[model samples]
Target: MSQKPTSSENIVNQKYDRCLADLLVKTGVGFSIGVVASVIAFRRRAWPVAFTTGIGSGIAWADCDRLFNPTRGPGVRIVSQAQTPESK
Candidate 1:
């Protein structure tokens, strides 16, 4: 029988899944935009423009992946603690 996964393992799995989803979304958007730009460039006879744009967009896509999928500890942190006024 397989042993149950520990809480830490579960958290890591969740982070991996979230990271994967983020990457997929970023990549999908980048590809769709690149395809449309290519079509337009072809119509306009601007092959060089399309090539440069594709390169720039690829860099942006990687940046998005890095921005959203942080490798640092489980991204949870308390921003503030509520405080109550002195008891009446």
Candidate 2:
């Protein structure tokens, strides 16, 4: 029988799944836009496809980084519970 995963493990798995989904969606959108832009604006050049794809991948990477390390992300703050005198 397989044991159930711990809370921390579940959280990690959820984050991973979310990251993967984000990457796929973002990259696919970028690729589609790139294809359109290549055909219309860039004279069917291959560079636009590559450049947009890279931009999409970079955005996904940043999002994943922020998700995995919330404290390290910009404008993020962690607040601890205030201790009362009675608890001290």
Candidate 3:
């Protein structure tokens, strides 16, 4: 017997799934582009494929990082409350 997943668990699972999907799509597209470039422009060199694939993976990683840590992303500001003299 197994219990149902909690809300937090579901959220985490969804995020993980999204990240995985992004990784696959981005990397696959990059690989395809790299193959074409290698064949047409790079004289069938292997580096273009590897380089483009790496770029795709890097993009996916940045997107995943933002999803997991929204506040830590670019242009996010954190504000702190000021204490009153009476409270202090």
Candidate 4:
């Protein structure tokens, strides 16, 4: 039989959900900007500018998520310290 999740697991799950929501928001903002920029560039007949702007927007959006998330990405770390016999 499967055991129920503990409090720590619940906290981790909540953090993951929050992070996912934040990422979704970031993605939406980036996609919206990309669409607007692409439309303007297309109207101006600037195909290269439109293409690059769309790609860059997507990349920047993902980067924001990676840079800001503390529970995931490069932010995960562990620290350890040794105790002297006297201290113990």
TM-score of each: 0.45, 0.77, 0.85, 0.46
lDDT tens per residue, model 2, 43-65: 99999999888899899989999
Each prediction's Cα lDDT score? 0.61, 0.90, 0.93, 0.62
Model 1 alpha-carbon miss at residue 72, Å: 7.0
The root-mean-square deviation over C-alpha atoms between each candidate and the true structure, in angstroms, is 7.0, 4.7, 5.1, 7.2
The alpha-carbon lDDT assigned to residue 28 of candidate 4 equals 66
lDDT of 1 at 3: 93
Best by lDDT: 3
Off by over 4 Å in 2: 1-6, 77-88
What are the per-model numbers of colliding residue pairs? 0, 0, 0, 0
Which stretches in model 3 have alpha-carbon errors above 4 Å?
1-6, 83-88
Write the residue-wise lDDT of candidate 1 on 1-88 in tens digits. 9998679777778766866676666556655666676677566445645565566557655655555565533575545446545557
Quote the lDDT for 36 in model 3: 100
Model 2 gets an lDDT of: 0.90
**TM-score of structure candidate 1:** 0.45
Model 4 agreement with the true structure over 1-88: per-residue lDDT tens digits:
9987679777768766766676666556655665676677556455545565556557655665665564566657655565434463
- A best-first ranking of the candidates according to their TM-score comes to 3, 2, 4, 1
Q: Cα RMSD (Å) between model 2 and the true structure?
A: 4.7
Q: Of 1 and 3, which scores higher on TM-score?
A: 3
- Backbone clash pairs for candidate 2 read none
